[model samples]
Target: MAHSSTASDKDPLYLEAHDDDDERRNLCGTFWKRLGFVGVAVVIGVVSVLGLSIGLGLGLGLRHRDHVKFTTPAIVTVPLQSSPPSNFVLNGLKGQPPQTRVYAFNVSNALGAPDGVVRPMLVVNGMFPGPTIEANQGDRIIINVTNNMDVPTSIHWHGLFQNQTNFYDGTSGITECGIPPGQFLVYKFGRFLTFTFGEFSGTTWWHAPHESYRCAHTFTDYSTQYADGITGALIVHPSEPSPPDFPTWDQDLVVQMNDWYHTFSSQLSAAYLSPFGIDGTAGDEPVPESGTLNGLGQYGQGGNYFNFTLEPNKTYRLRLINSGSFASIRFSIDNHPLTVIEAEGTLVKPYTVSGVTIAVAQRYSVLIHTNQTVQQDGTFWMRANIQTDMFTYVVWGQNTDVRGILRYSTAPNLAAVPVAADDPGPGMSWVGDMDTSLLVPAVVDSPPERTRMYLVVVALENTADGRFLAFMNRTSWEPLSGTTSLLLVREAGLERHNATSFAPVGGSLQDGDQFYVTEDSIQVVDLLINNLDDGDHPFHLHGFRPWV
Candidate 1:
């Protein structure tokens, strides 16, 4: 009985106590709390790392945006020196009025903004577009070209025929190497004959001759160094300063369209990106701006704005010139009719149109009657939007960038329109096949004062870099030659020649004049054309349209 009690009677109280102790034990509570604290610390460290990464990313993004905003376009001033002589007197012919006087000056290249920056330029009468020269039909013109810059230069009469007076053609090699720097040359020619059909008053332009190549080559980095900013207009009025018989407006606006290439850095990186190539081809470079009116750049807010005053009912003559190296412009006055009267200095039968397309070297003189109310603000815009197959090689295709304003005055007593008797209808189109017989008839018996021949030679040679090198009359203009001794040697040699024999010189022209025959009795002026595997050069003549 004692042995059995030893196994079963092993204290029920002790077993109960053991069970109670097991039930009261807090086994993993402390461990769980410690683990939770560790987890919280790890989470805080990860969150801090993420916040710093986000902050750094935001700061970098803002800095990049600010840098882009700071690179804004700026206004560049180009120094344009004046043409040398202050005054010139052109001689007269037999039975003609006395020689007319013309002022000569230069427009130098100013290197900064339009408001300041002064550079040497060759201008007539100290104006960019030379002063309008008005004369009777038979009056003679005397132009004394004075070179005041550090380079040699010449003046071309644009459309006037040299006939026997080839020396005054204004072409450096053709007439004579333009007067050297600090030198002077005089050009005298007469218009003793009357036109049979062409109108007396029209639009035209004038520019520096081949000698301008000196500047052209020197400033090749700047697209418009020699041609764009350096050029001007030449308005040859039919008669003296008598008010027009037609209704006239209070102001006459002459808008000269031009292209410019400015330097963003001293290294000419901006010019290097120019879209318009030096020889009129497409390049990978950038073109900050294209066309402008009155020397205003095409970018920036209100940088190139032109404002004009107009009465309620008066006619205004808008003379437009397509002075760019390439691109024809489509000009129009929004909500107004344009009555075109002339083209390229030749009057045409009037015609009306909503807009007109003007080709390179072409001029248009339109008479617009602003009869609308003052509330109707009008815009006279010139856009180069016409699609042409000719611009296959041009970059960005065809686009115009010139515009101006034609605002009607709010003034109470508006200007009165002249009688309709003098207001000619829309003029004829100058784009048709020109009827030679209809042009100014050849002076039947009047002996030619001078006769000269111009041979236009174009060459496009392959360059070492696989690009084509273009040249006028076989002379590849070397941009680097500006600071070289070759330029001075050429200038000194050109100065030694007789000024009279200056007609027809330069590269192949010089060689031709030396090797080709010059007969005295030829009547008609001949312009021989030869394309030397080069690109096509659109040859232009001012004042008078050349017959093909």
Candidate 2:
């Protein structure tokens, strides 16, 4: 009634002070209490601010944990194999049980000499290009890999697909995480059915893809801690016991082609970057005493030198695998003619050629008649001719070297050798005549299903900064950076017209453009030549096996 102003009508500053006073009084009562309240408020504000700052710092710290500066000590393990595992034979066609066995292997680096020549690396079964696993088409195959190294390792069944039974696919992330060091992984295949014809009949291989890493052409040594030396071949033969017109045998021979590294800078650079250098600074160094057949380095050297005794007139099947990192081989006997019956593991028409060019990831089954009129010294020289281009490292510019020897006869008198029986070895033999039966064109029983095309272009770049760059399919392989996955996606997304962008901007085309795609259930890969050598590319496909 006296018109006294309400608390809301009081001066703003006075009202604010009054509210603060009320708050202080509510928090406490006496003068000492008010001071205590003010102190408590200040403490609360400080605590809140400190808590927020700490929480934000912790979040940022967690987000950057992977970026923390920390050098990981290099972990090296020298792989060892107590003994070579027993080879398996394909006996299913002969009504016999399929041969299966377990193999143990180690992966480690081979320390080089003190002269800066030897570089440590990851190897398999104590050898670069691990042991060869041989079996016939109808045989049940089981491979037990024990990773004794300090990192995770996996085996990819290149060119072989498990189809519905995807469990047998050896891809690290797609099928399994692979076997970590000190662990064993069992990869089983061929238990379901036998391959009648097509892709399964040819040469196939296995290698470690421990995660995504650079391959030959992109990186100097090819990425992956184990790629420099840890690779191998898997040859699956036809169910038929005899290889066409060839004679059978008690034992088989596996020739592994490979390249060895010595310089830490060269090896490490190649392993993590490009194998080919701009001028001559990076890539494979000439291994003075490397290169082996069955883990045996040079002939007559400490490496595995093959010395097999052949009956004067008996025939032997040579199962050859071109497992070299970047070498192409021209294999022929000194004075004997060689017959090629299969290529890439598939049965081709038995054709006699002067010499077969074995590129990377290629397999050939041939019948070498030790039947040469026996001379006291009839030596069949197996040589691997290196094929390089302008892009090839000058360090590897040398002529062919003798791979191994095929001693015709051990008899004192070379001429008195008897003709051996033509019985197909202990394995299953094909029912019909290989020449006529395999040639009869069979009718198409099913209509084709799906189709896709892939254009393969090799990219080469000689930068102004003296840097050389090379790539397959126009995409430069980024070593260990794990950028290939993204590049592959971008490649797959481009339209036909946009495909040109895939090639290197200013690089030359070592190999021309070629497209590979599946059509109507059949996968068709066409290799188009632009500037590539007349040489063939032992192109290996993963997931699905091709018949060509």
Candidate 3:
């Protein structure tokens, strides 16, 4: 992985995905290790499920997606890895001077440890949890992504309107081919964007959007990718002279929370996707081994933590991001009430909350005031605890709660305040839930009458080689290969050589496979999503933010 700046040629390599043998080997090993019996008793149990039909490659009521080999035009050279540029631009979006911003990210395993535990994690610019990209609404943003790993990679700016740059949407094989190993790719934004909100910036995130049940979280091709790392927060500022709606705040804090695991994601995915469990029962999605706030936490302990310093009587706006792989967490600061200001990217009518429930991949901005006298010695605990017993996974996470500190003192990385003195504050009762129907959108929710309506049922079925497969309207999303569905349609006239040039395979079939929709004319689509799964799943529709 030597550093070079230029790349040419469409590099395509077949990913050496784990085979049945490799998968079974992991299943045999992990199930034993997970049970804490690496000795004789565990070995016998591992051998029992080795005869599963999953490895035989027979679909058990689930339609298997055909793998497509995709190719990209350019590859990036692995210039020597370096720290993030210290002087990156930050625009308030109220009326920024610069119209363009540049960002360089080296997708590599070389970086400081997240969770303070050195594991096989992918990072951006050598930063775990990645770096935040703060820019004005109208500014052009260019991101140079260099893939230094053995596998290909891609990045998706979730919730952002790609507008004219659909290829830059970053859904591998669907929008664009991935950046190959030792190669680089550039994603450019704002080419076709007309920001009506003047310099608008909103809270969004960038992560690996090439969704494979295996490697969906991380932008890499491998299954265990995101579990290792490769996610970050992005804040878009509207204009330089930002709208003066802010009554005011002294400081702004970005608080990101997630569930962590010691085991590789692939291992857990293998089990979660497998039809049979390690002990010859229905498979269960592996629970997180722990939780982290801004990439710092340990099992059942506040190892490295998210610490906040506040001057007395000052109001600080906290941007809360639920970056968990899969978990809805309740976020709250003890002895403080949160004033909800923004939901997603839209500013909401300010509302008070004792604790807010954050679903995965969701973002919120709340205002916290330092009104209370510091309890338990000038400190309070900021809690992001997983809502257990709500989700129906057979297994449970090792650590249920992750706590950080809210200190009145101005210090970076001070020794932890004594937990013995930690008071959760006359624990306020968080009853029921937030009323979403009552919450109003900052922008008017107006659209042409829905022309096409779809009732999508989200469920997990005992199919796909005997594994628990997630589906939408019985259609689960699997990556497409060769040409992207986008490219196929946009460039439909480019190639009429094949009779089925733009046709989606098995798309017309029912009950569990990827579905392709193509409307020759622009049509408003109303999707009525019915969540059949016992657990609540966060639904995010890319390309457009529809009124819910």
Considering every candidate listed, which one attains the maximal lDDT? 3
Candidate 2 per-residue C-alpha lDDT over 1-548 given as tens digits, one digit per residue, 9 for 90 to 100:
00111111111110000001111011111111010111110111000000100000111111111111122222222222111322211122333445554344555555421111234655665544466665555555656666666655666666564443333454433234445546665555433422222235445667765233332222222224433556676766556554444444433455555443333323334432343432234422122223444333332212223334455565555666665544555565554555566665455545444456665556776666666553446544455444433122333322235354455555453323223222222122322212322331122223233233334554344444544444355434333222222232223324332642122322222223212221212233333423242323233444443333
- Candidate 1 TM-score to native: 0.54
Regions of model 1 farther than 4 Å from truth: 1-73, 76-99, 106-127, 190-201, 210-228, 239-253, 263-288, 374-400, 411-467, 470-519, 523-537, 541-545
Best by TM-score: 3
Instruction: Write the residue-wise lDDT of candidate 1 on 1-548 in tens digits.
Output: 00000001111110000001111111111111010111110110000000000000101110111111012344333332221111111111123453454444443323333212222333444444344443445445555555555556555545543333333445433234345555565454433321111223445555664231233233422222234244555555554333344233333445555543333221223322234333333221222234455443234432333334455577767777765434444666545667666666655556566566665556777677767542333323333233232332233311234454445565332332112222122233433322223433212234333344556565544455544334445444432232222223233334655422221232222321122222212234445767554233345532234444
Between the candidate structures 2 and 3, which one is better when assessed by lDDT? 3
| Per-model lDDT | 0.38, 0.39, 0.53
Q: What is the lDDT of candidate 2?
A: 0.39
Question: Model 1, 323: alpha-carbon shift in Å?
Answer: 2.6
Off by over 4 Å in 3: 1-94, 110-113, 192-200, 213-224, 240-246, 278-280, 300-302, 374-376, 390-397, 410-433, 443-448, 491-512
Any runs in candidate 2 off by more than 4 Å, and if so which?
A: 1-95, 99-101, 109-121, 127-129, 165-168, 171-178, 189-199, 210-227, 240-251, 264-290, 299-304, 388-393, 396-400, 409-458, 462-538, 543-548
